[model samples]
Target: MNTMTLWHITGWEFAALAFAALLVGFSKTAVSGANTVSLAIFAAVLPARASTGVLLPILIAGDLLAVATYRRHAHWPTLWRLFPAVAAGVVVGTVFLLWADDAVVRTSIGAILLLMAAVTVWRRRTADKEEEPESVTTRPGRLKARSYGVLGGFTTMVANAGGPVMSMYLLSAGFRKLGFLGTSAFFFLIVNVSKLPFSAGLGLIDGRSLLLDLALVAFVVPGALFGKWAVHRINQRLFEQLVIAATVVGGLQLLLP
Candidate 1:
């Protein structure tokens, strides 16, 4: 929009995007898994495919803040194992994006979220009954890393909505709050930055989207600051449950008529 109508968007649309941006910041530092809410909201307010482009920069901003706060705690071995698979997934996602229509994309994202939520629940329940060693059952083996990494990369590249996949993987690997946040923070910062060239090559990122990002980015700060405070005090079990519940809700919202 021109200077005369720089603020041309409707109030509700502005409000939705700002709210979504706020959620992006909070999810980055706190839950590390609830960002699908932000993704869903951004897609609801913008075009489904373009929303991924517009939100990427804002996510990177939050990623910087989170990594600064939790840099010391990242598990490098896990990152090393996952990166190659993640790159493979990104390439796959790029190919997929070339052919998928908006409806197909929306359906794919919703289906991924719902499927992930189901997998998380099943893993949780199985772990509860079997009671295997944390080392045996919870850590990311090569296979686990490859599986989750590929899915995380594909989901992120497709919708800017891979938080749950990575979150579920970390949680299964038995990362407590700080470790979870630190590793996820570092992972997304790298992965998201890596996606910039691909998104640009696809002509997904442009001046108008950047302009909208500029308008909404300021709202991320307060939410991120709040997340840092909340993470320190939140009950761990409750936090995990909240993340899963929110994931399910966000997935369903994307699929609803």
Candidate 2:
């Protein structure tokens, strides 16, 4: 089904989608991986494929708000290092999408989230004992960026689930709190908006999805505002942990039922 059909959903579904949209903004601004919750919700409420289409615009909108708030602090050099690999990954993901039906897309996202979350948690635990990996910055440079970039691109393109992957990389690279949010906000703004053509070509986005996006768009404002306030007040360690936990739960939900 196309975007036009989403209007037939019930009021309860609207409520659920609206809340998911709110989380989109909050996650984009304050807690990056919290978006796994919104992704899971969208996949559950709509088919995995169509949900991806409908959710992209909403994510882009949140990205814009985040960029408006954090754009000044973005680390552009890091982005340049990663974009080439990310573009390659997007091509691979588009190929995957061509062959995947709903079940394949669903399972792929669920598995990716679970694996990435585990990696993040393990890296965090071991970070104190070892020097941060050079895989994300300096030294190994090209090889490391390509590795993370491909994974990040593939995951983001498939399920918009790249946040956790990037979060782990950025943390290991020792980005300060503001730098992390700013880099992420802009990275996704460019990336998500870039996906529009591929998504449209795949027939994943259209009038129906756009309509759903517009209706739920306003809810993102309050969520984004709350995120901005909380980011300044919350402890960084606590926020990162919460994002990981939420991602794990969301991954489990998708894999289970």
lDDT of each: 0.82, 0.81
For candidate 1, lDDT tens digit of each residue in 1-257? Answer: 12223245689989988988898889988977677888888777766777788899999989999998889878777788899999999999999999988788778877888898898888877775443332232456898899988988998898887888888787777766777788889999999999999998887787877888898999888889989999888876877787888778877877775
Inter-residue clash pairs, candidate 2: 3-208, 3-209, 4-208
lDDT of 2 by residue, 1-257 (tens): 55655776889988999999999999888988888888888887887788888899999999999999998878889998888988988898999988877677667767877887787677678765443322223332577678878988988888787887777667656666677898889899988888999999989888768878899899898899999998988776777777778778767876776
Q: Candidate 2: where is the Cα deviation over 4 Å?
A: 129-140
**Residue 56 C-alpha lDDT in model 1:** 92
Indicate the worst ten consecutive residues by lDDT in candidate 1.
129-138
Every model: Cα RMSD to truth: 3.1, 2.9
Candidate 2, residue 229: how far the Cα is off, in Å: 0.5
Worst window of 10 by summed lDDT in candidate 2: 131-140
